[model samples]
Target: MIIHFYNILYAFYENKDIINKVNIGGIIVKNYIIIFAIEAGLTIIYALFSGLNLLNFLNGTFTVSMIGLCIGLFMMMYSDGAYSIMGHSFRKFNYMMAPKRIKETMDEDPDFNKKLRIRQEKYIWTNPILFVSLGLVIISLIAMYSMV
Candidate 1:
């Protein structure tokens, strides 16, 4: 009976299941959800094992959120090593994850700064990791609040 139930659940969550589909910024939700599950799952397991009675889980949730926030913030904080007038980018803290094309064009291309501006405008919209971190932070915060 248990084996039959297990198979049924597995079949329902099969790869072709449309109900499980979600598109976030051209990235699939399940891909990052799995990453989230691993992190959160381990936290929950640790909490349970340590007999903290959910307090540990709450701590883990906040920690995960902070981790995400830190990662996203740090990613946006520093500029890549490219053509910026010596201390300019360091002072301003412009986009850190400029594309190879943008980095390559920075020094050689006269219109690099203009292109960098445009690129920065469209920036962070395409970073899946940043999005994941943001999602983690939001979800974890919500979970933490509800738990409290």
Candidate 2:
């Protein structure tokens, strides 16, 4: 079950079309909000169900939440860089695969080229959902750590 869940998460991260559809600027803003929500939700769950000192757990939760936030931030930054490269490669592949002059000409225009680059950049760099999911995973790991 855990492995399956992890695989699903990985699949989501690997999905290029979904990443491309999302706006990078929106992603950056959404990520912070989502991460905060995930942290709060996890903290609440741990407090209610886990066998731990409420106050101590709260402290640990906050600490873990910060760590998760940092990890999420790092992932977002890394993915942004990686996506830029990957998206560029994909766009090149698409250009190559395009049929004939009409298709080729559309991709050749300077304005179109510029827009494509910008869109690809945005797609590659931003993923609010992934960050939120990662935050939850991190929080879960922290809870387990505290238990141990």
Candidate 3:
């Protein structure tokens, strides 16, 4: 689950810049199809093992499935766009408010600062979504357990 969440976040963040540059709509459609396949597989497994009536389970799962599908789809389509826009806006605001560029001192040691900035940017892009997804997955597991 952790790995899957990371993959999702990575895919979102890495593609963010390219999203505006390329065919994001097509990418999002492909992502939805992949998710739909996974959901279908899960439905089949649940039907086979849970002794739940297929039609009844589908009825109950439909709404939750749609919610999950939409979340997944939107995350794929716009997560990066959302993050990049927010990040850019905040950086612009900070630049306007700052006394000077903090990198002036680091200019003499450009490589070190460049590496640190790269690491920081990667973490900043990934951490929030990871933590949020972790929370959601935990809640989902708890809910599933309660149902059982």
Ranking of all candidate structures by their lDDT, best first = 2, 1, 3
Highest TM-score, which number? 1
TM-score of 2: 0.35
lDDT of each: 0.56, 0.58, 0.48
lDDT of 1 by residue, 40-120 (tens): 776677677767766667667666656665765555544332334444555334435667675666658664453233112
Question: In angstroms, how far off is 115's CA in candidate 1?
Answer: 13
Q: Per-residue lDDT for 1-148 in model 3, tens only? A: 6765565667677775432323332233343344445555665665666567745355334534545545555555454466556656666565456565554544554443222121122222233233333444555555656667
Winning candidate number (lDDT) = 2
Cα displacement (Å) at residue 118, model 2: 9.3
Q: Which consecutive 10 residues in model 2 have the weakest lDDT in total? A: 116-125
Tell me model 3's lDDT, rounded to 2 decimals: 0.48
Model 3 ranges off by over 4 Å: 1-36, 48-50, 101-148
Clashing pairs in 1: none
Assess the local accuracy of residue 14 in candidate 1 as a C-alpha lDDT between 0 and 100: 75
TM-score of each: 0.43, 0.35, 0.37
Count of clashing residue pairs in every prediction: 0, 0, 0
